[model samples]
Target: MQICGGGRYDNLIGLFSEDKGKDVQNKNVPAVGFAYGFDRVIEALKMQNLSPEFENRKILITFVSDEFKDYCVKVVKELRERNITADLDITDRKVRKAMEYANNKYKYVIIVGKKEVEENKVTLRDMESGEQKFLGVEEIKFE
Candidate 1:
């Protein structure tokens, strides 16, 4: 029941072997690699009750259009700088679809639309309480 395996490979070594760029063949440097059976390991963890709990501190930023992409990215960067787990939805999905995707995974959702862009504000929605408010990007507070 090996959940993971690793050792060494001697033939795999080079500066750029795929020849995509310059194939500068270097000496065989000692390297080791390992891989895990991710699905099996997760199942074992669940059975043993060793899986970690969700933190629920992550927030999702969804935009109405590409027009607000820059603003949304800036907001995300600010949140990350403050040590908050923030992610931007770049899938070009509709606002409703984005909300559905963030439904159970994120604690809050920051919606950036035309109004928010023009006003330098965002609509922050609490997923748990179903409460929302329009706030300036700098005014968004996190727990």
Candidate 2:
């Protein structure tokens, strides 16, 4: 096990007054320190088959019709450029199937349709809460 510990000793400088041959500090000095032996902790957790959960924001850009496909693709590209974990269907899947797939894997779903494309906005849906709202592309904080 990678057992480790650490501390600071400010007054410890004064204990070294006998400098052997060279002149050194004989007064207390301010100090601080810390150490991490998390390798051991991680090893123990691994032995128990324990794992940490990671939360990732997932967004799927879905379109209702083929006409909106181009717009959805554009929006998806923009989101990805902003470092968002966003994707869209390239197989021209039906809206129902697209939504089902999104709900299974994504935390958010952005629906692009004729109206949304014309309005330059999208219907952002929260998969977990089933709540949705219209949002401008600039308003989406994927980063």
Candidate 3:
């Protein structure tokens, strides 16, 4: 069974023929690539009964008002760009209710309010630690 297969420099001449001149010489390019048997790996791990540290990881963002909805979208986009599992509350819930929901549903809660928007900052609360920190919008690192 091929456990993995890969190529590093695949010369996709035919695919880019429109861009390549008709008389373009065929060049042999160096290439490498690979893929793991995910199902097999999962079965092996299951047999060993190994558990990961964090099985459920998620972040929740709550916007205090419609005016800050755009900012909420921006924050969610930033988190997603960093490969973080994040969701924004778009139910038009009150700040307190949204915060309560987030505290119950996610490990982290990012609160963005009108004041925060005006100040260009966001408040990050650790649901498990109950610790909070205010970070400038520009200071928040996505990646």
Best by lDDT: 1
> On TM-score, who's better, 1 or 2?
1
Candidate 1 C-alpha lDDT tens digits along 24-100: 44544678999999877867776777754324558899999998999999999988887677999999799999999
lDDT, candidate 1, equals 0.83
What TM-score does each of the candidates earn?
Answer: 0.68, 0.59, 0.56
**Ranking under TM-score, best-scoring first?**
1, 2, 3
lDDT of 2 at 9: 73
Put down candidate 2 lDDT per residue, 19-103, tens digits, no spaces: 6345455465767676767777766666776643212457888888888888888898888787677878777688778889877
Give the winner by TM-score: 1
In model 3, the worst 10-residue window by lDDT is 48-57
Q: Write the per-residue lDDT of candidate 3 for residues 1-143, one digit (tens) a residue.
A: 34445666467654566646565455435456677887666555656676342224477888877889898888888777765678889997887887788767787788888777888778988788989888864455532
Superposed Cα deviation of residue 1, candidate 2 (Å): 18
The whole-model lDDT of each prediction reads 0.83, 0.77, 0.72
Worst 10 residues of 2 by lDDT: 48-57
Screening candidate 2 with a backbone cut-off below 3 angstroms (N, C-alpha, C), the clashing residue pairs are: none
Instruction: State, as a TM-score between 0 and 1, how close model 3 is to the true structure.
Output: 0.56
- How many clashing residue pairs appear in each of the predictions shown? 0, 0, 11
- Superposed by TM-score, candidate 3 places the C-alpha of residue 20 at a distance from the truth, in angstroms, of 58
